[model samples]
Target chain A: MSEHHEKPEISPAARRFIIALCVLAAVLVALEFIIHRHAYFTTEGQPLFFAVYGFIAFIVVVAGGVGLRKLVMRDIDYYDQGERDE
Target chain B: MSSLVTLLQIPGLLLVFGAAVVPFLPHKLRQAYMLAIIALSAYWCWGIDVGTHLSTNLAGLDLTLVRAEAITRPFALVFHIAAALNVIYAMHEKSRLTATSGLAYAGAAIAALFAGDFITLFIYWELTAFTSVFLILVSGTPRSFAAAMRYLLMQVSSGVILLAGAVLLWHGGQGLSIQAMQANTLAGGLVLLAFGIKAAFPFLNGWLQDAYPEASVTGTVMLSAFTTKLAIYMLALCFAGTEILIYIGAVMTLFPVFFAVIENDLRRVLAFSLNNQLGFMVVGVGIGTELALNGTVAHAFAHIIYKALLFMSMGAVLYRTGTAKASELGGLWKKMPLTMIFCIIGAVSISSFPLFSGFVTKSLTIGSVAKDGYFVIWMILIFASAGVLEHSGIKIPYFAFFGHDRKFEVKEAPLNMLIAMGIAAGLCIVIGVAPHLLYGLLPYDVKYDVWEAGHVLGEMQLLIFAILAFVFLMVRGWYPPEIDSTVLNTDWFLRRALPRTVNALSRPFLAAWASAVAQSKTAILAVLHTGEETSRKSGLVSGVASTGAAAAIFLAIFALLLLLRFVA
Candidate 1:
């Protein structure tokens, strides 16, 4: 009973589905790297420019994480709260 | 004499007058009248050509209804589209109150667009405030009523300041022609404040978040289009390149993303996102270059459709499920596939994914800002742009349509609602695919292209990369779930804090009134007590004093006879 209040339980199938999505994303990103190596799918700058790219990517990822932590959300009764109680 | 042709330039005014009479019509005829007026308003706005300036002096000042090919045309055109879309959206809605108020709202905004002079503009400005509040009232909710009143007060107060500015302008010897005024004058400052209120300039933008979410679904769609856009149009015309709006726009753009992120209400999220979007236009308007102005016009056009689409989808969710919170809703895509698809399209458009309406239009504003060498503003805008993607792009559709649907089962949006959403979704794609369709309607000829390789790659990098981040969060189960009653932005300043502060400050004065009553009672009681004591003392002393006087008189009579004999 206390466990129910702790958090809604995530089903095993849903958890597997989420893992599969993650794997799929990683594979797609790796494919982009491979395809770019063959003189096709050129990037804005050289893909090997790790120092500059890594810094920029890190900032973006960190900023995105911060934003997700801060903003990216919805509420349970966002539409239906505080109404018709006159 | 040919200038008088400008009067015919906006036949939408007469149609507005007709719409005001629509509600009074017998029940069956009401909708038909509303539809006819909408059609007529559309015709007047789109059919009118690119040249006609009607100017006749009211009092030595040029009260020119000059139809210059500038901001008004595009603004008016969007108003026409919004009015028609709103009418179609409300087709199945039975509320006569919403119908009348919606039409009157559109009419008032259209009138403001064609307003020849400051006086005309101010009148229509207030009218927009007056008519739109009814849409909220018809919702029959106490919260809606309160929100509408706040919306009305703020909107009307903005109009009052505008009117005051016009009066000052007339007195200060600036001619009444609807052109740019210098920022130095009293009228100029007043007008800026008025426009600031309407434009949802940073601190003054509370009314939007307060009111828009509370209106009826169709009412919110109509609400999204007119009020803030009208202020932008006015600001574009009168205060272009004022320099201050640049920073103002940047702050407006960046500040709302935080609030929007934390916000629970789907409608209010859109409202915050709108403030952010308007900041882009304000930046462009402040830039005041031809391309920047074109960008502002084009963005407003695209934004109207996409924003309305987003609202429609959410409204449908609200209608069917009876709730729009992310926590309560999950796995709804199975039920509302069409709405989901339309919502995704709206999301893509707002996110400015390459080949969407937002991509084609919003880039011009950012690009122009960059070209103008406002590097700091440009960087802030880029950061804000990323924030926009985080909040509106991923969060909206993800939570509502895609995320853990919390296993709630609900029917798809009604056919009427779907049709409305479909129309909006169609417009979004059309604007994205054929940017010229929208760009052609712009006040200036825009040579800027949105599909250049550099532009496409940059946007793709930004949006796709952002999506990767969203995916990362969801996979980790680190995302914030929708909750109930998210705190509102700037509105807390006026809605919660201001009223509380005033009450606290006035408590002593309130107590003083009772104290005054107590003091008056004490004074009257003291007077009565004094009278009672004096009468009692008089009664007690009278008998003794009279008896003593009688005894003294007897003794004095004998003494006086003896003394008289001696003296003789």
Candidate 2:
């Protein structure tokens, strides 16, 4: 069905990035287990937390905006030819 | 305003009657008539009293035209908005019956929220069921007809259960004063069960997925707002703190995500996600604290916008492209940029992105659960939230808007369609950006700040991480994308597997019955033919033999009866 569409190739850099993410996730999970085992994390007020929150929010908004513009869009009638009830 | 509340009582019916006349009118007048009904209904909504009684009965049932209280206000406000917006969205459709039904459905739902008595609620409650069915029928497809029947049956059954409960409560001399449901009694259970059916509680969930997808694009938009939310509203008001709802809510949240993951129809996926979101409000209602109740009400308020926005986006797609199957769709964002943007906002909001509408409203429920120290429920809720992101967040957008861009061309959504979405999308953001606008309307004061550093960071971390997981799975081809195929969940018990099983189990029985019917017909025909042949061949002989036998039997019976009577 997608004969005219070329399959995009995956890059090594993207693969490396994914591997790094996996490693970071593992470290985070390990940290969570350790902290829970010792019960080290507490809901205490911290300025650094707020800063990080704001920063991440900024990053996400920008990233999501760009991604929507670049990757996620379509013509209104793009799939008009597909199955539809008259 | 108290006097004005009475207008809400009957205006919906009046508007419906007025809308019924639209078809006979000139083409230009149809939209005007529909718009007038909506305008009048909105005017009536503004006049209805909140937190006060409008009418009461000798049986001590307090019938209020409006309860501007924190709990009911959000529902009424959102419903009014949705009704008006649906009118706008549906303006271009030629079906006058649909407009009339929409008016009646919205009016009934709006009145139901204001009902201080079970009787009044029951009246409007059934109105919602009866009138809303027109929407599906207006679709004019065989599938929609069947779906509408199922939807009507389910909704009518809910009304029956609710009415039965009301009757029991009234007769038992309790004097119906709408309050929380009790666990030990038949009446309370029936009422709770009624709400459960409408609320799409785990097992009773199939009707929504079955029906909503089959509705007209605009019909589904209206469908998204009222029925389930009203159930939640009832649950919040009447069954608050029923501990079972906590577990039920947990299950409701977690289970649908998996089905949503593999589901092909974007609308059905949204329907599942809707069920998941309702679970949060259910949990809050079960918690039954001021904060929790506030959470439930607030969540309902926020959810209406975002969910409608989501539906609006998909509806636009379906309206223009005519199919909502994820696999069959790709890359229409170029033509429908506004729709894409709006849908993404809806997605982020549903995913509870920090600073989005869902973030503020949903956290209250999550926070309340955490505060209550129900660690397991909270954990399940978080899991469900992640699952929500997976199905609705990545799946809906990735397939419908972005995926492979199948290179088909269609015009952007109609101007009215864009306007409808634009309004709903704006609300999603506005409510998120300034939650106090919504939070202030909560039944109880919520002291917790949604934008607090901890809450914001925690939610951001969770949602962002979930998105990362989705992207990772997708990029690695680990994400399941069985688009254009249904991935049944508990609905399987009804929609496919149960129906299939029933059909399978009945095949032999039906065949046997059919064969028996055929055999009986043959035997009767054979007997008739034989009798005709006998009459033709031996009519005199047969009559003489019959007469002789009849005379002999009459003589024997007469002799026995006469002997018995004489002996007595």
Candidate 3:
């Protein structure tokens, strides 16, 4: 079975939601500089460290999942194959 | 929290036997009765005070029937709370077997929390397994049957290992008490391995993902609360400061996030999320500070509630729509708005949003890690935090409620389910808003300010940006589409490779056995041939008078043999 290639429908409400998310992200990014962040490690003190790390980590995790599917995903009945259904 | 060591009989064990009669009661009466039993048990746990030795000698071994650590009180209290909640959550179900077993399972776990010695612990260890397997079996599907067997095997294996560890402790001249021990020792390692399997440490976690999702909806809700948390409680007691667990836990937190992202079953996604949540607790155990231990206990308490809420919401979805696969579920928010809200609350709580249970409780563990200066681990945990948002915090709600609307025409979840979720959601908020309620129950004082400006801002930034990435992926069609497929985990070892390997290895022996059977068949056939051939030697039976000739031949051979013997 092929992966569903259906693109999500973005309505006016969804667009507004995305815009709000973007604004929230922008505000958080702005606050990273304004908020005197306590840094345990030296690199943690860098500008926009958390935002960059979080955004990239989320992408990596999702993208990594795509690659993982190729290696591990089996037919839904993989475990049931050849066994009589109880 | 009490360091009370007394051999007084605790009353939690009675709930197990009390459940035996649960099946006989009328449904409404049974619910009320079990709740009363649980309330009574909670009262028992609340009444016990600390610091006296009271172990009875059984067969020359001091069996500690009653024990309490500083951490024990909260665990015992929450377990009773969960027992009561389970009764309410399953109130609408008619299956007497589920109620009876679920209540018994909770009882066994609570009893275990008070066990001062390893022997007592082992009994309850297997008791929890034996009771909980019924929940999985109640699902009544072939898939669930197979999963139940595997789940039982892993669980029983853990108990057997616990027993063996206890025996080893005795042989080494150490008493069979459940005290902190060095993991490098054989007995300690065996005990830790036992706890690790139940704790769902990395590779051993397959059963959690395999079985929990396969349970009956109410069964899943009940199953979510007890078994694994019991394991975590044991791990914290036995293996705090064990360095390997820190690394094991970090991998545990990281790997599941990726699997959860591609997992199509919403319930299975939550199971994976449970594994990840356990990792934070595990890291706290490994850190072994007062703060870390407190974190572990607090996290378990909050985790049980929110995790059960998450499972219950999905349970509602499964009950109403008859499916939990994300590929088939969407737009449920339209029909089940309240359930959707509860699910989102669960999602946000698990995601550690600043004003939820996970935020306050989970911070202690992360703070402990940061304070301990395990930089790489701290980083992995942070990344995994974002990953939590990806799967649980976002994917569960987004796919089940808001994603490409599947237009399910189902009604809202049952009244009982909503009530269960509402109470749990309220607890999450109460604990989050006034952290001290839970803090006061901790084994040690919670000095970490969860509401600190810096910590809250950083957590918000992490979550907010992760949301941005999700939006980015969705707009670009870059997100992996949910497809219903078997996502392989360590269980593949038992279900596939182990069986296949055994069959392959037995081929030569099977062939030898078949050949030996064929050789034996030939020998038997040869012996039968002589008896069947009466006229093989024509001279013996000879000419015309066949019956007389045969009789004369037999007499002549007998006479000749007698003569030959006489001559010899």
* Candidate achieving higher lDDT, 1 or 3: 3
Task: Please list all clashing residue pairs in model 3, or write none if there are none.
Answer: B4-B51, B5-B52, B7-B54
- Interface RMSD for each predicted structure: 8.3, 11.9, 2.4
TM-score of chain B, candidates 1 onward in order: 0.90, 0.87, 0.94
Among incorrect, acceptable, medium and high, the docking class of model 1 is incorrect
Residue B181 Cα positional deviation in candidate 3, in Å, after optimal superposition: 0.6
Cα lDDT tens digits, model 1, B1-568, are: 4543444355456555667577678755776676676776676666556565465666666655535445666777778778877877777777878888888788888878877688878878988998889877878886788778888889989989988989898887775656788766888999999999988999899889889888887888889999999888888888888788889999998888777766777788899899999999999988989888888888988998899889888888888888766666667888999999999999999988777899999988987887787878876777777777877887788788766657766788888788889988898998999999888878788887677654565555555555556555555555555556446456667665676688789889989988999999999999988777655735433456756776788889989999999999
- State the TM-score of candidate 1 restricted to chain B: 0.90
Report residue B115 deviation for candidate 3 (angstroms): 0.5
Listed per model, the TM-scores of chain A against the true chain A are: 0.35, 0.35, 0.83
Q: What is the TM-score of chain B in candidate 2?
A: 0.87
Candidate 1 recovers a fraction of native contacts equal to 0.04
**CA lDDT, every prediction?**
0.76, 0.75, 0.89
Per-residue lDDT, model 3, residue B10, is 57
Candidate 3 global Cα RMSD: 3.6
Candidate with the larger TM-score of 1 and 3 = 3
Per model, the share of native interface contacts recovered reads: 0.04, 0.00, 0.70
Model 2, docking class: incorrect
